[model samples]
Target: MATRTIIVPEGMEFIRDELGYAPAVRVEQRLYIAGQIGRGSDRQLVADKEAQFTQVFENLRQVLEAAGAGFEHLVEVTSYLTDMRDLPLYMQVRDRYMAGCYPAWTAIGAASLCGAPGYFLEVKAIAELD
Candidate 1:
């Protein structure tokens, strides 16, 4: 049986403490990262669309790093956006962090995310670790 290990990076303890969920989980060579938003260290949501998209990727990066992984390790990624019109901006910001690493991606238009307005994006991913 593969043992499951919860991943909560150095600065993400509040996720488990307050949200009652692990930011990421590792089972054998696979890591499942939870949905990450555009919130910063203080958990305040970023207001600008472009900046929020960047922050969303940064949040995902933090979870990947916690599992000793990176964008290259990502095998699949699912992005939820409140507005489909923001797809171009999302892709642009995503490209900046993804660079040459290409993973299976799916972007969905969502009515709302995180159960609130102003919260525009949420990203979740699965990674394969060596």
Candidate 2:
């Protein structure tokens, strides 16, 4: 299968050249998204946990949309959090965006994330298109 990089708009291509990875890569019917942080369009980390969480999902949405997919196409998700105490809040924000379409999920607690120090969480996803 041929692999293609999903083109991201300016200021949002966080991983392409910096991390040596495409923000999202499409291979046939599958779209693999890199871990998304809570950074705003300005490329700065959001301070509030809920706000940051929302931004993370928004970032994911952008990549999916670029690849002609949506939340419904998501098959799996992996999240990394700086604190497990934020799990409840994270789930609440996640449910708000995810609605009833559930996907396989895994959450991990990490000592720190790469990027801004205020970043509390990051999310990675896999989506399958029909």
Candidate 3:
């Protein structure tokens, strides 16, 4: 197997602009994704927290699929939050995506995020796939 870095510049400019990393990387059959946020296809942060968390997972799903993988392949995840108080809501939406398979996870409480207000949470994932 070979390692690869995938940059979806056609739709995601913030990868280089904000994080200075490619959108995703494949290494030895695993995909280590950069941090994904609650942004839409239009690249704007959804104003609602539940919607934002939903969008973030959707965005991560897209990246995983782009790398030929799926949610069950995720082995680890790192989550950041501008407001830890929103974790319940975040987890509600997150559980819907995770389907009871809990990956190794780390969460940090933060003062703010890169985008607009109400942008409560951000998360990145590492996936093992074929």
Candidate 4:
């Protein structure tokens, strides 16, 4: 079997040193990005929910770009939210980023997110390479 893997960038050592995981991975025809929160490059959560969501997708965009993929290539999305009330906002954000095609998706409420008070969202994506 052959595999293609993407290692985290330098200074994102937490993904490996702390979390013991890669941020994204590609095997054959699929790219899987790990659940991402609203935290910015500076490691601080965006001040607002909608803004955070935007930043999150932008961050995911970078990850996908690194894997030579795009939102249109996505086939599935799984989102976890700390509050159900944020679902609409989440969908709106998703629409903003996803544009025309809709991928198979599921967004569910969670009791908490990675032990954070302000964070209310985490999203993962699976995209097809062919």
Candidate 5:
């Protein structure tokens, strides 16, 4: 099987140079996306909870797009939140992006993530391309 790495120019420096990992890797019809945090194109974490959640999904969308897939193609989604209290806000943002098609999902409460201060959440997804 051939593996294609999905590279996002805005996120490549840290994700590839610093972290040494591809943001997404596609093999066969399946694409595996790395855990995406609420960071801007510049790699800085967003402050507001709602904005952070949006950024996380936006990042996922970018990777999926690069892989020739969309939200509807997502087969599974896993989200990690530092605070479960933000679930309501998360659902609101998620609905805005993924209302029509719902994928199997898991939400986990994380005490902390990657030692990044002010980072509150991370989302990872698996997509099956048509």
Candidate 6:
């Protein structure tokens, strides 16, 4: 049986302690990352669209790094947005972090996220580890 390991990067314990969920889980060579939002380490959400998208990616990066992986290892990604109009900016910010490593991506329009109105974006991903 493949061992399941919960990944929680340093300084991100709030995800498990408060949120009651692991940021990512690793089973063998596959890592499944939970939806990351624009919240900072202090648990405050970034309000600006561009900045929020960046923060969300940063959070994902932390999770990936904790699993000894990077954006290049991502095989699939799913993004949730409160407004479909924000797609362009989201793609732009995402590309900045993803560089040229394009992964299978799906974007979905959401009415709300994190049980709040200001939370505009969330991202989840799957990665293949070395």
Least accurate 10 contiguous residues by lDDT in model 5: 4-13
lDDT for each candidate structure? 0.92, 0.87, 0.82, 0.83, 0.86, 0.94
lDDT of 5 by residue, 1-130 (tens): 5967665545455787778888888888898899988888877789998999999989988888877788999999998999999888889999988998889999999999879678888999998888
Give the root-mean-square deviation of each candidate in angstroms.
0.8, 1.7, 2.5, 1.8, 1.6, 0.7
Q: Per-residue CA lDDT of candidate 1, range 1-130, in tens? A: 8999999988789999989999999999999999999998888999998888999999899888888889999999999999999998888999999989889999999999998789889999999999
Give the TM-score ranking, best first. Answer: 6, 1, 5, 2, 4, 3
Candidate 3 ranges beyond 4 A from true positions: 7-10, 13-20
Question: Model 4: runs farther than 4 Å from truth?
Answer: 7-13
Residue 44, candidate 6: how far off, in angstroms?
A: 0.6
State the local distance difference test value for candidate 2: 0.87
TM-score of 3: 0.86
Cα RMSD for predicted model 1 = 0.8
How many residue pairs clash in each candidate at the backbone level? 0, 0, 0, 0, 0, 0
lDDT for model 5 comes to 0.86
* List of clashing residue pairs for candidate 5: none
> lDDT value for candidate 3?
0.82
Count steric clashes of candidate 6. Answer: 0
Off by over 4 Å in 5: 1-13
What TM-score quantifies how close candidate 1 is to the native fold? 0.97
lDDT over C-alpha atoms for residue 19 of model 5: 86
Q: What is the TM-score of each candidate against the true structure?
A: 0.97, 0.91, 0.86, 0.89, 0.91, 0.97
Best by lDDT: 6
lDDT of 3 at 53: 89
